[model samples]
Target: VQFSDSVSSLGIPLNRIGTTQGVTVSLQSCTNGVIHNSGWTDNGWCGLGSRMFFQSTGTHTIRAQVREDGFMIDQIVLSPVTYLSTAPGKLSDDATLLAARVPVLTSTVQVGIGTNPSSGSTPLSVNFTPNAKLSGGSLAAYRWVFGDGQISTQGLPSHVYQSTGTFTTTLVVTDNLGHKASNFAKITVNNPVTKPGTLTDTFSSGSLDHSKWLASNEPAPGSISGVNYGSFVPGNVDLSKGMLCLRLQQQQGSSGVMSVGGQIQSVVPYSYGTYEWIMRTSSTSSTPNGSGSRVSGQVSSGFTFINNSQTEIDYEIEGGHPDTVWMTNWTTVNAKQYTSATLTAPDAGFYSYKFVWTPGRIDFYLDGVFVSTHTVNIPSASAYILVNHWGTNNSKWGGTATVGVERFLYISRFTYTPL
Candidate 1:
């Protein structure tokens, strides 16, 4: 039995009740699928005494069945009483042959709010689209609350904010039956500001600036793959000919199971900034046992690291697909990962890879051309900049390196400017 009540407490009646334990009843609030257990009670099998409190006043479903044999029921009693005490059964006067009827509504309303160009200069033009997921319901209207006191009835409208601040945007969806659901997202705006002086290094001095870079030698977390392996090799980082080289090589071990790579991290942590780097990647040519070419499986990446792997943004290039670049954004709250479209890589030569990180968004660019923008799960903490080339056994990411083969990624220049 399913019904809606403005208040809690319900009266029920059962007939042909056995002396033994009768049926057990279970109720569920369909709104959130919460199950409420109502234990066995023998109050003459029909009374206003068996009262159950609903956690909420929405639609509910009730089910009853015999816990023992020889138990039967005829009908469920509906009461107008807001509260019920230990009242005696009035079966003959209150019992009915039918249960109260309520409209069978299985539909639900859901809304998702998304914005384009989520963060930019003041007076930013943003198009808000309410992605509505309506199941078995007739949508009557869409109400958009822009968080700025402005309202709109249009389903999907483009609104331009003429201010510089973070705004909470919400969308409420209503069904014909007056049921409503809402979802919210944040929009950030900032006044255009000049670039705050950049720190650039070209590695022409033939040695790492120890004050700015740190050599990281730690075990890569195993959560990404099934096994935890790989460590930083200090010898692999070479500064020669005005280029910083990160080399990846398979370590000495039985069965070709271990490998080592190079990693470098900036000593200074950054919060919101534009990070850019010019790099080209290459691997040694090879043929596996004279049959097919064995391509190197190296992961060359530049990214910002806050505390964990879950709170970072990355610009990664894999040796398996030398011409493809991947952009990723992650948040530690839900461990949600947002990835961008497959960006075409340069055919030959070093290319510019950059990402602008703000309070509410992160934008990716390749060779000074806009690649993609991600507005969800933006990080808001200081993070150190890192660059590395590594080999992983995880074939999905970067295949394990072949035994005794070396792969290298070169960075001609790197720069960062606070925004």
Candidate 2:
């Protein structure tokens, strides 16, 4: 905006003329197009309360550029203006402008903060988002002070507070006009309940590493009538398309006795850690003409097994109950304990199941979210990791496996981290 006047100072008048929330205006000398002053206002008309300065001006074009949307100009007023040598031409606050320039603005930008898992044990990880609204401007900068002396400038950040106590977190946002607003939130951190494990596995390769895995040729335990036991078939266990596919195929023995399924286990053993699997499963009901009797579904599982006293931790997807998952831990062959929850069947797609084994407890998770924690009879001995697809003779556990039937389980990735 250019104006011709004898007035020594300039006020290029501005207003919020539209519904668009944020609008910013910058005033600069037309001679060199250098910005002299800029400000933002949500309300209409001279909300900045300040004037632009130019040295000894005659007829000058003071450029008014909309740095943000929804700002409108009414007119340029030439008034007598002066600059203090102390602050130079730097932009002043609304209080300073009210004392030296036009009427004061009624409001400033509003800032707010939101967090996820807002409260948890110490060493808690929290995710925060800033919600700052500006009428005549956009966010130019962000400052986050996480109550604990740590700071960040990211719009959204995840931070882990290592100590236990209550803290007040603060956020400050600056607009294009150099206006700042602040907001704060309280986070309560308690003594950490769970520590992280040290081992992790994400299957990114096209084939399973033989050095890490071995097939199980033994029959499933606690066998029932009308069900065939499983033996490991190397060809049935394959890694292709970045997934480990374990298939249970009913095969007639050379003596004509049909086998139930297949299984694979880790070559190494882990005593205590966090173990996880991303997988899916598929099965079918037995045929009407039972060359051999088969049940409706199969048992697909990811577990840890030790033969010493037969210690185990099981993430078993029982086929008969399509949507339910069973979590079981055993200290001996005869002593078994379990809990269950319903989940969308993996056959529909992929799902994540995990368990954290500590000396005194076992924590279970589904898709990175906590599900259940078991404190009774947690396995203390190291065990080999195991994955299998098989059928039990009992209809209550796993539907019986029928001759000429097949079942499949696909594991895309397995991750283990020792605490």
lDDT of 2: 0.65
TM-score of each: 0.49, 0.47
Which residues of candidate 2, in runs, are more than 4 Å off?
Answer: 1-204, 222-227, 251-257, 284-295, 308-310
**RMSD of model 2, in Å?**
21.1
* Tens-digit lDDT string for candidate 1 (142-239): 88877778888987788888888899888888888888988888888888544335678887688889988987777642113334257787787888
**Strongest candidate by TM-score:** 1
lDDT values, one for every candidate? 0.66, 0.65
Tens digits of lDDT, candidate 2, 244-286: 7777666445443354566778876777888988877655412
Q: Looking at candidate 1, what is the lDDT of residue 27?
A: 28
Instruction: Report how far residue 15 has shifted in candidate 1, in Å.
Output: 49
